[model samples]
Target: MCGIVGAIAQRNIVPVLVEGLKRLEYRGYDSAGIAVLDTEIKRVRRVGRVAEMEAAANEINLTGRLGIGHTRWATHGGVTEPNAHPHVSGDLIAVVHNGIIENHDEKRQALQAKGYQFESQTDTEVIAHLIHSYYVQDRNLFSAVQKAVTELVGAYAIAVIAKDQPDVLACARMGCPLLIGLGDGEHFVASDVSAILSATRRVIFLEEGDVAELRRDQILILDKDRQKAERKIHVSDVSLASLELGPYSHFMQKEIHEQPKALSDTIEPLLEAGFVPELFGANAKELLSKVDGVLILACGTSYYAGSVARYWLESIASVPCQVEIASEYRYRDAVANPNWLVVTLSQSGETLDTMEALKYAKSLGHDKTLSICNVRESAIPRSSEMVFYTRAGAEIGVASTKAFTTQLLALFALTATLAKIKGRLSDTQEQSYLDALRHLPGSVQHALNLEPQIKIWADRFAPKEHALFLGRGVHYPIALEGALKLKEISYIHAEAYPAGELKHGPLALVDDNMPVVVIAPNDVLLEKVKSNMQEVRARGGELFVFADLDSHFSESEGVHVIRTPRHAGVLSPVVHAVPVQILAYHAALQRGTDVDKPRNLAKSVTVE
Candidate 1:
């Protein structure tokens, strides 16, 4: 996933573009670059963070009222200066793109035949040449971008500027996200709202095949057919303060401590006395009552949240549920039931694999599509029939913390709503669940208080090369997420298994050097997982466990126990997630790795 920010204003926009790209740094990028429409097309690029590009840009002193910037996460090219974005064509046209061009090879060959020289190995370079080819013919920047997008075969969110039209900028998007920010005598476009939030909160979300022309005085929007179109302007509620780290060392650590507030924000609406299923949508109750089962599709941390939801749906709602990784969902010929309620979970809502999977699932005749998304105006939410927006605010950390917990809360609420609609839950039972939801914020905060003890485990785990995480039942998914968080930032090889499955294979991997983490909540599975922990201890493996106070587990020769807060029946997964996140955060901090931007990973996977 790459970041793109463009602005057309009456004053010099170089500072605006750079600042915007800085805000988008959390999206994950390998290189940074910018292009300004001065007397000539001035460009600066570097194979590092936005700060490097900013320093390099200041030296050039490029001045212009219209400009575009990009933070590239390399797709088809290596990390080098030549592969950085803000790619130029001829002498005037400059383009910055996000997402992949599936037919770049074919298009590149066609351009080569026309004597067009390529600069980099990136698929985005083909777009600069393609747009320039169209611009030379019509000499109209808007028409050039519109025609060039029609020739493409894959996802792209692009911004283009020409030296000839210094006052004009054009942008278009399909399959990836792009939006416009309305300002006084100015306009801005970016792949995400966080990039331009400081300048304007009034945003116009672009659809799958929308193109926008941004001029200093007027802005024009067009659809795929080139017809004039209109999109609603939304005033975002995310405050600028939410994007900053006031007292934390890194954003990951800040977000780890923000979980309690984030959980409260997410569950506040559903905790009301008379809350109903219509909170999701008017037809939510009717459709959920008729559905025979649930099918959940997601990727990465969101998939783990869905995994937890599978247990909740079957146990609490008494509905059959299945969870599939979005990337492999379409490749397999899985059975799609028309009566199954399809739920798609995503934080950015622009995950390309998840979006394509949602489309493919729809084509197979399933109409009951619902999206649990963070951004309400994002592509996946727009395509779905109904939506549940997660109020986690802006999560800037590449290693997700608050977003994951909020997703679990949202899915849990969905389970309670479905259970009430299906007559499995009485009014009193539902109220009891709501009461737990209301108290979950404090429970999360109580878990957060264990950070000092969790950090001690991280200190010991930082030097280990291998680890094993164990959980069972609903907590199995939480264990998986714990393993993912550790490996994502700390780079330690880790794996997770259901405690029962230890004897099947993972037991042999246990040794003196391996750190085995146990998520031993005070549920029925506690005794079973205790047995699994004994297998590890019997083999000389070190045990670091987060257990409930009443579980009666104590520290021993090889076992290090960190007693967690009170047991939270079904909602224990959300509460238990805190220590896992804290462990990963401090471990990565101990290892001196880039905790916020891990190696070879992007925060949002906008491309398959």
Candidate 2:
């Protein structure tokens, strides 16, 4: 969940490394550091934001043609300068790493027995010492990094630079992402492509167990077998402007307001050509036609999106669907069906638990795999048999906004395709659903216009410590997502339950001081949820209901009705996802919390 940036250029590399770290700050960090080979290995570290390190770095006037930088999210150590990255060993090797080194304790003791004193309480420190031990034996920075990676266990993406070898830089990754950026008379390494997008768009994505050595003129890569390998170079389409905040105060606000464009961009192609299995892949039709069930695997907000999809897949396609959290999917033994289609979802497509779960499912003879993700070149999509990308652009906020909505749109399209393939969807029904997809952008725009009123509610309800969200049928998952957003960004304790389950247990949590949120769309479950709302009001719990325009609800004593725009049937979740995001965004603002980067969270969960 950290960031790594490295460069070997003709000019001083300090500014470039700092700029790279700045771009990665949205990924989340508690400490930042940079190391450079200026005559000797010079380093600077701070326990706060990257700005703190930038100021500390400018004071020393560190200069070098080779450098590495890191923004660390504490895993094995506390948030202190000594535990920050760019861990040094004997003043020879400087290493910056992402992901966990699973066997650090054993290796740390071995190094200590050999008289190598550690300077930090990080698993990354062992990486630097392991490389130092090999460097002294062979005196080759590239060879030392290659040997050290094989001796280590668990997932990691690392960049290394040596004091003796100032012109060369080395990097390797296993179960984590790393890429090489090619520039004129320069080369770079970064965990994310956006870090080096300003420097060069020409990049190479390293595969599992691939190691690379970058120099000023040439780049060399070796395969898992230690043989020379050839990898394709890709030109990225991510613009520098996408990474900027532009006129918005925070990235969550910008991304929340950008949902209309993001939703339209994601489903534009499907809207033009209509739903077809060939849109996903050439063989999608043949394989999907034979599948009997669907198994969805994801984590966090993506998992909630899958939860919404479960309702669609079962009703539309007449298929049994099961959604599992990726972290626990492989640990339990269940009936594995060969005819079940396994679908994996992720925004970064590099979630460690999801990737390992996908691999585990494949090992158990589930061959029909499809990936829905934002990054087209990410590891999960590359490992899957077929892939669909959501055009949400760059979601920099640690609390996801646009990515969750776009995933709902894509999952809806899949439901339609499966329904048509199974003969459950008639021609007229298909056209009606497609028409709703066409007007979804306008509906979401209408929802975003209610932000002023939503903010007012946020300010009034910001003082509460506990909240309850209620929804039924398809909207139950949306309520769960609402609770997650509030707790993660606003730091307010919130829980969600189906409207019918309130009498069983959650009813006791309701009191005069508690605020209960209700998601009531004009569907079959609207009457049942209204009864649930009254039960809350009867117990002195204030009601904040997000109702459709036609629902005919008014603001009365202890009840607040926020009228939402008219939404298409079955597409209501995509529209309802907006206000909850706005509620959480403004609530965090009222609480004086970091709205973009929350505590103990990162944009990409690259480590388990």
Candidate 3:
């Protein structure tokens, strides 16, 4: 996923573009560039962060009334200055793109046959040439862009600026995210809302195959059929300053500590009023009542949240549940039940694989689609029959922290509602769950209080090359999430097992050199997991256990124990996720790795 920001305003827009890119840097950071249209197309690009691009633009004193910028994550080519965005054609047209063009090679060959030379090895550069080829025939930037886009065959959110049309910007979106920000005597376009949050809160979310013409005073949109269309502008409730790392060392740590507030916001509506199915949508109760089974499609951390929900849905709601990795879900010839509720979980709501999976499910006669996402007006939410929004705000860190817990909160609420609807839970049971929801924010805060001691454990883990995370019952997904965080940020090789499976084959890898972390909450399976820990200790494996307050585990020669807060039954997974996040953050900090922008990872997976 890359970030794109464009502006058409009365004054010089170089500073505005750079500031927007800075706010949207979490989307990508491999390289950044900007192209401004004044007397001619002036451009500067760097094979580094946006800060480097800003410095280069300053050194050259680049200025213009309208401009477009991009921060790239490198899709088709390597991260080099020439491969950066703001690619130009014959010094007149400049283009910035965010997605892959599958037919770029074929288009490039056609352009080359016309005696057009290519300067960089990128799919984006072909777009500039293709637009230029169209502009030569019509001399109209908007018409040229629309004609050129009709020939392309993949996902893209692109912005093009012409030297002749200095006051105009043309942009389009197909299978990727692009939107317009409404302003007074100025207009903006960006891949994300956070980039333009400082300038304006009012925005128009462009639909698929929509083209926009942005000028200083007005924005005109055209539908896929080349006809004028109207779109509603919605105001965002998110504040601009929340995007900043206020008083925190890194975004990861800030997000980890923000879990309490995130949880509070997510569960506040559910706790305030009694369980109402309309919280999801108008006819949510009717749709949920007709459902007999649940199918979850998600990727990465969101999949782990679904895994935990699988346990709750099956046990508490008496509903059969299945979880599938979104990337692999659409490729298989799996059977789809029409009565099944297909639920997709994503933080950005624009994850390509998950979106594709949702489409596939709907094609197979599963029209009852629901989305659990943090964003309100994203692709998945717009395509769903109902949506449950997680109020986690912006999670800038590539590795998810607060978003995961908030997803769990929403899923837990869904589970309780389903249980009550099915008469599987009594009023007393519902009240108990509600009381636990009221106490969850404080429970997460208590978990954060353990960070000082987790730092000591992280100190020991920083030098280790590999780690094993073990859990049993519903906590197995927690172990998986923990291993993923460790590997994602710390760059440490890690794996997770069900603890009972350790002796199956993983026991051979555990020894004095490898550290084994156990999720030993005081539940029914605690004794079974303890036996598994004994098996590890017998093989000379060092152990770190996160036990509940009442668990009878003490520190020994090689076993380190950190007592967690009291358990909250079905909500234990949410509480357990905090220590895992803190451990990963502190471990990466001690290891001197980039915590916010990990190598070869982007915050959102918008492309395949």
Candidate 4:
């Protein structure tokens, strides 16, 4: 998951490219680089944050009408200046890539035999060499790029600039995302709309195997065979204010605190739209009404949200639901039934595995494909038969906070809709669930109030290298989400165990050095989770808990409890998730890690 931005302006565009790179910095930050073609050669590449790269580029001459910039999340190479993107060939063909070449080894071997020496240990270098090789034979940049891409396998969204064709930039996408922005006397291309949001609202989302030849005043779309193709231009609705952290310390913390608004945004639209029939349209409602089961595919935090939703779907809707990790779902020999509804969850909406899984399910004739996503007009939503959008705004943190909660909110709303559609819940029950859904915004606000206390608690546990998260029943998935977030951003060795499963194997890891975080929300399993906490305490493991308000636990004991408001069985997962997010945020802060741009993590996993 890397961010790529390119611009061909009527005037010097280095500042615009740098600004756009900064906006897209949340996607990746291991290294940043820019290549601009002007009267002479100007290139700046560095192995650090965007700010570092910008500082280095400031001292150089950045005058250019066309440029491309990249913030890399390393794949197939180490994080170094030589490996950073905007790789150039000997003839000054600069390129920025966002995906891995699966057949790079074969391509590199052939190129090496032809006396093409590689400088970097990246699959992306193959693209530069291949393009250079084709240009040497064809002498046409666009035709050379098309020919080179025909030989490549795996996902890629690549933008290339040649010194001979400084007025033009050619871009192509396979499995990865690439967008072309239509601006006044200029053109822009980026991996996502966030990079070009400030410069242009009109964007042309390139489909797989589509290439665009962008110039300062025009853009042309072409197919794999270089045939002309029509393109649709979509106007983005993103606001500049959504990218700011506002009053929060980091994007992660700001997103954590924004859960209340995010939930409200997701719920209000559905409530105002009535029920399932109105939200999913006639086709989706007809299909969902006869669905026998649901299979959800997602990755990381979104997968954890699906785990929690599985319980809700089974319990409230009386539908058998299975949650599968998208990265592994396609590789397995799983059965797909005609009555099965395959749902995919994604925050950026461009997650590669989730998109591939959706396509695979559709290929199996499971037409009832639904997507739960936050970003509108994303790849997943475009490919699904129906889509439920979560209005979580812009979640810039590499470790997701708001996106997870909003996904849960959307899934819970869908569960309620499905329950009503199936006639499983009575009027009073539906009313009760609806009322609870309305009250969630306030409950999330109450959870946000615990941030200061969590920060204080974080100071005590941040020094520890290992931790454990435990929960029972529905809270078990919440514990898993918590542990995933902690491990993702803080680089902590954390594990999540169902409280009941601790005795099986995880209990052996408990010691005084291990800080165990227990999700003990008051429910039927509260006592069970408490007993598990006591077992950890007996083994000399320090405890941090998000307990129910009415749970009977001594406050002055060794246990650290962050009390959550008492809620119904299904609602506790949404409430209990907030504190764990806060814990991860504060812990990362205390450890002095880059909370927003964590190491080895990207906001969107665009490449499989």
- Where is the poorest 10-residue window by lDDT in model 3? 271-280
Give the poorly placed runs of model 2, Cα more than 4 Å off.
none
Give the better candidate number (2 or 4) by lDDT: 2
Computed on alpha carbons, the lDDT of every model, listed in order, comes to 0.90, 0.92, 0.93, 0.87
Q: In model 4, which regions exceed 4 Å deviation?
A: 224-226
Error of 3 at 568 (Å): 1.5
**How does candidate 4 score on lDDT?**
0.87
What's the TM-score of each model vs. the native? 0.99, 0.99, 0.99, 0.97
In model 3, the Cα lDDT at residue 37 comes to 84
lDDT tens digits, residue span 266-320, model 4: 8897667655655654577787887888899999999999999999999999999
Quality of model 2 by C-alpha lDDT: 0.92
Q: How close is candidate 3 to the true structure, as a TM-score?
A: 0.99
